[model samples]
Target: MASTPAPTSRRRTGATRERQSTHEGFLVHKSGRWIKISAALAAALILLYIFVPLPPHHFGSSWLGYTLGTVGALLILWLTALGMRKRAITPGRWSLKAWTSAHVWLGVLLIVIGTLHSGFAFGWNVHTLAWALMMIVIVSGIFGVTAYATLPRALSANRYDAEGAITEKQMVEALRSLDRQLHDAAQPLDRECAILVDHSLEQDPFTGSIINRLTGRYPGDATREAASELRRLRAHRPRVADDPLDKVDALLTRKEAMLARLRRHLRIKGWLQAWLYVHVPMTFALIAALSAHIVSVFFYW
Candidate 1:
């Protein structure tokens, strides 16, 4: 008699679904409550801007403009506080996750507040310069949010193989393993092929500029060139299964694939980090300009 199959398959599927459902990103934490709150705040500010009476030609010196400017300045300071908050790990209601969510949404709100405060009056002056710098900081922050949401999964997938997930250290070790095998395999080869193998071995996989890290383009990739050259050299010769050239060719091919994966990982990492370079510096510039704008206003008043 055929026995009924157990419910293990159904249980495993349910567990997987549960895990996926529970995974909460800071951007969407608590159904994006911070984002909703920020939206409401921005809407209220926009409506206030529309209804508030003002002179026919208004500048930031106007009452409503001063209010928005105050709000925007406070928001900028609070947003900057995240840089410090991130270093202090904590949990619960005021968790790092909650702070980050607030930071992102409130930062977005600054665009509306700042633009309204400017009264659409842009010039080559300190006030307009502050607004422009604020825009740069916001745009860079948006890029960072996008990268954080997406790149980790790509990085994880890049590190996985038939054997399972590997760490950054493992990736380096894999490359070293291939290099050692190639060295041993090519020991019996002639001068020309030996030089090719040595070239591949001598090249550092991690040696590249920021552009190379971003683009994943290695025009002088020694392993790739050596692999192609060895394959070409073997093409005209008789097929010999035990040839050291054949082994070296296989090892070199594997090394090329591994290096490609490692470079791709680096490129993804570079994207994840590149935004901070702009965000942090521009934030400081915005603060300086903001200080100048405030001083100029009160000084001239």
Candidate 2:
């Protein structure tokens, strides 16, 4: 007679299945399965390169070198396929998450494969240029990984205030509303004070270069200058109840606060997107260089 499994064992199996089915972030998808595979493969290749007896001078033309070169070229083609995969939405086994996990880890694996293929011979040639471009793409990818990991939290924290979370559209609207209030409040102010308020009101909210977005520094920010000037002038004047300048000053201060948050949002958003500009174009360039490298190697070299 056979014994039946206990309920607890059955429950454990069910729990394991449930956990496995639950999706995780691509980096840790399948409990870092792709990472482990890449690491193991890289280690194996390095060991083979070091221990497999072959003359150093002839290594690039050796069987192992040809194999590594073929694998690397094919891997690059597959990695590029990720861009196409992103267009379709699907689930299970070869899901976008799994594809992305493979893309990142296999992309990393190319470093070892490409270096071993070159057999450490470097020069000012198409081969070296292709390798350099690959390196740039990898480094840019690393930057993208870091940005995606950290920036979302910073964006979330920046958006939340006493009231609740604010959207990008809300942030812009808040600035516009404050500007309207400032315009009305400045009606009774003397020309000098009114001019200060106008400097802020007439200024465009979105006027800044890429450098300004990245660094979050706007030296010529009219709002900041207006607020500072209003404070300096107010410090010298006599205090009065409900003075128009006081209201205008308050509005300016509020507008300044809003602008700070809005710029922070823009800065964080820029950082998140900046890497793709380099990574994508450089990838195409790498492919072009890689094709030239292959042609030279097989037909010309």
- Each model's TM-score, in the order given? 0.89, 0.92
Strongest candidate by TM-score: 2
Quote the positional error of residue 275 for candidate 1 in Å: 1.2
lDDT of 2 by residue, 238-276 (tens): 999988887787788888899999999999999999999
The residue-level lDDT of candidate 1 at 272 comes to 96
For residues 189-257, what per-residue lDDT tens digits would candidate 1 score against the true structure?
Answer: 999999989999999898888899999998899998998888898998898778888778778878888
Whole-model alpha-carbon lDDT for candidate 1: 0.90
Which candidate number has the best lDDT?
A: 2
Clashes of each: 0, 0
Cα deviation of 161 in candidate 1 (Å)? 1.2
